[model samples]
Target: MPASALEGIDESTWVDVIQKMDEVYSQLIDDEIELEKKNAELEQSQQFIFSVLSAMSDVLLVCNERGVIEETNAALCELVGRTDAELHGTSLYELLADPLSVERARTVLGNTNPARRGEGLELNLFDAQRQSVPVDANCTPRVAASGRRVGTVFVARPTAEIKRAYHELRSAHEALKRAQQQLLHSEKMASLGRLVAGVAHELNNPISFVLGNVHALSRYSNRLRAYLAAVHAGEPAEQLQALRGKLRIDHILDDLPSLIEGTLEGAQRTADIVNSLKRFSAMDPEDRIPVDLNEVIKRAIHWIGKGAVPDFEMRWQPGPPLMVMGSAGQLQQVLMNLLQNAQDATAAHGKADKLVSIETEVVENCVRLHLRDNGPGIAPEHLSHVFDPFFTTKPVGKGTGLGLSISYGIVEHHGGVLSVCNQIDAGAEFLLELPLAH
Candidate 1:
């Protein structure tokens, strides 16, 4: 019955069905061709990546999520001094001679993601000789298309060159530090020597004056005692009193009172002078503290003005208290050096108008200090080297050239800047700008 029913239908309808089927099959074949193309491209890309890794100058390794070495390039194998057969199944630490190295590597790899770069750790890798060779290594996390967290890929280069460079830099730095310490010691000794000379010169006058005054007082006491003894000798008491009155002893005794008082006053003055000298020289080269610039200026100038170069007029433009984080003794040295310089420059020039003025104010966030002197100004050539070690303009016996250099180091350590410039008309002005603590 089925065969008989088929006899009524036209065969061309079946042709159309066959053609549709053929078209569908054609499309399927096309899809298959396209897939093969994609497959080829993927194979080529993998090959390219593998080649690049093999050619890399640094050791490269890829690990699975379990920290198992899934793939390693030639450089990595050679670095561990092992073949790929030995390294592929091994953990990163097992290949590294020390467990700590692998632990650090794991840490580094943990931090690696697409968002971060320029992060790495440098450590030592043991070579075949069991000697540690430095290596700079970094690892980052790599994710897979299966939506799972993959293990880290480590890329490291032998750090022998960098290690050598570091050793050289360290050596140089140590040498520089020693040189600086020696220079500082020499400078301290020099300063002490100058201080000794000044103190000796200063103390000699007071000592001499006191000694002479004591001698005079001693002689006067002896004479008076003898006179009293003579008066007390065996004559009638009333007669002796009458003789003393007749001589008008009260008038003569007035002169003696004056002499005694004068001698005591002179001795007190000498003592005060000696005390002041002690205070002035009490400066310590290493003591650091918060200090007022105004007080430092006043102390230095007052101490210097006591006996030597007393004719200079010092003027202070009082301003707000200038506070600084610095060494008190160092700043004192800087100011004292400046004032002494001013005095020397002005000694020959000023009769009464010899002047040194200290002015201070704020410039933005920095404190600006100016010490201006009306004296022989510095030449332009000497201005640049004022803070340089062993650079001094004074005659050979006078200046040791370390005062300004040490001052420069102190200011630099405090993050301040010091500079000197000659005034437009005459004299020199030093500018010190110190940034306030933030």
Candidate 2:
């Protein structure tokens, strides 16, 4: 029946079967072409990514769950001075230069999902020369399309350059701090020199007067003792009286008390000058505390005045205690410097109405202080450099010129500003502004 069925098959049925087979074959060829295109595209994409990884300067590594290096970038190969074939199948932990780092990496890799481990890890890696290089490393998990953990990827950067940079930065900071300290010391010495000069000049008269009076008193006492000895020797009362008269005992007794009083007053004046000098020259460089600007200003005024009221008419417009954080000693020195400068300017100009005005106000959360002198204003050309160290307008010996510069530094340390400008119609006006403590 099979033979008879085959013979009975029509030519048209055979042609139709052949046509159907051709159609199926054509469809298979088209599918194969599409598959090849997709494969080529995928290969191209992988090559692009591989090229990118190879081009990167940082070391990149792909490791399997066993912690065996499966793939590495050109950077890693070059760093180890090995070809990829030699690097592959190597233990990642063996590449670490530090024993502790190797142990840490091994422990981390023991986890089922080793990815997301070793973030911010600083490790020492061995180079081809067996020299250790610092590096920072990060790891992340590689997952397959089916959501299975396939491997771990590590990205690392050489930290030697960064460490060098950081070390350089710290050195620069230390140098800057040293320079600042030296500047502070220089300024303090300059202030101390000025204080010495002022004390010498002001105390000279009183001290000299006291010494002269003491010598005169000593001679008077000797004369008086001689007269007393004559009386004690039982000489004639008239003779003793004559001796006293000849010695001028009456006038000596009368003037002794006044002379002693003048000497005492002069001594007291010297003491006050010394005390003021001590207070004004206090240079506690590192003390910071809450202090009242008004009180400091008043003390400074008293010091600069040197016992007697200052020659210039001075007025203080004080506000409520303006509390600021600063060194009291330093602030006092600052005020003394400013006041002295004003005095010199006023005295030089010989103003008939020599007036120095000081005022304080609170504005915009800041404590503002203003000091103005009725003297000639600063020249425009010299105004900008007024606060510059060693800058001066007076005679060389008359001024060390560190007054304003040091004052400016003190104010800055207190988070304040000191500025000077010429007043509209009179002299130079200085403004000291400080931020109020919260």
Candidate 3:
């Protein structure tokens, strides 16, 4: 009620108005106390936030819309090596490393609209000694309880230690990679030594048998000539004939041809095996030349066929002799290993139309050789370890497990790649890639 309305009111009504005023006054005092309590809580909260900001390792800054520094934490003061009074009124740009970083900071801070947050710019701050200190800054607009934009709040942390750690981590990773490769190379050499020893042992048996047969044949030939001389000399034909009959000369003559042929074949086989071993073992690790990969593949197939014709139907699809820069012997070994594997896989399946296919092509200035077989594919669990040293699916004594591993190393030494995978429909496939020679 207005004071003008009170002038016309009766005394009793005025007294009632006075009582109501007293009640209103008491309520107002209670409201004032509650407001005071809330103000005190707000002040405590502000102090706590300021203390936390001061304690942080990262620099925190409060800037107004005009991009002037309003307040900063102890971190900022320590980084600048200045007192609070010296930094309080300075522009944020003045502390940045360069004009570009200054411009970026200004642009980010100028956007005071709460909807548009800063882009988290990275800047380097210059210390009192002019040393660079890298920092990443994330800025956002600060707003009051009345929903008005007050200023911008910046949070930044130094990234020098983080970057140093990253570089060290990268170096350690490279060292570990080199160590693993060295271990693999050592294992490959050991396996090759065993292979050589096994081959030598195998060759000794047939060679010894051949030598014995040759000595026996020489003695038998001498005996036959001497007996013929006795018949020609007037020594009694009947006696000589009787001796010949006793010696079974007729049977000897009949079987000699086969014996000679068998001996020749054994010798030839030993030679072939030796030749293949020579090709495999005569590799010069440092020698690289422009080689015809198609020729290498053909030679590998021929050598593999000479040992024993594979049970599988072998198909060779040779393209115009693709040239690549690599070690011929090592590449040939790689081809032989793959082809041998394909042959064994297809033979084991014992399926009709068992085919081992070798195909070559020139694609994208690289030669690609693909060997595939129609047989049981590699087991899924074993696929990942197929190229690992001493990993094999063959029964013990049937395989040494170093074939593929050595082949892989050989290919890598030649700056090529060897990879294997299960075919889409059936069997497994091996792919070899060699960069084209310039």
C-alpha RMSD for every candidate: 14.8, 10.6, 11.3
Model 2 has a clash total of 0
lDDT string for model 2 (354-426, tens) is 9899999999889989999989989999999898655788873466466787788778878899999999996
Candidate 1 lDDT, 1-438, residue by residue in tens: 598877867889889989999999999999999999999999999999989988998988788766788888888777768777787877766666566776776666565453334347665676666667667777666677895557777778888877788999999999999999999999999988875675565446546665775776676566566557758787778876776675545545766666666667656655754544444433353554677777777777777776485677788866667777666666776778777778878875664688888888887878888989888788878888777545677764355555666566657766788788889979889887777534
Whichever of 1 and 3 has more TM-score, that candidate is 3
TM-scores, all models, native as reference: 0.38, 0.51, 0.47
TM-score of 2: 0.51
Point out the higher-scoring one by lDDT: 1 or 3.
Answer: 3
> Per-residue alpha-carbon lDDT of model 3 for 1-438, expressed as tens digits?
788966867899878989999999999999999999999999999999889978999888888777678999899888878877888877777788887788887776665444545558788898767787988888888887998887788889888878899999999999999999999999988888876676676567667777877887787787688788887787887898887887667767886887787688668767865654454443564687889988898899888988896677788877777998877777787888888888888878889889988888878978888898999989999999888655678974355456787787777766778899999998999999888988
Give candidate 3 regions above 4 Å deviation.
1-29, 51-58, 82-86, 106-115, 128-130, 139-151, 207-266, 275-438
Model 1 quality (TM-score): 0.38
TM-score of structure candidate 3: 0.47
lDDT of 1: 0.72
Worst lDDT 10-window in candidate 2? 276-285
Candidate 3 shows a clash count of 0
- Considering every candidate listed, which one attains the maximal lDDT? 2
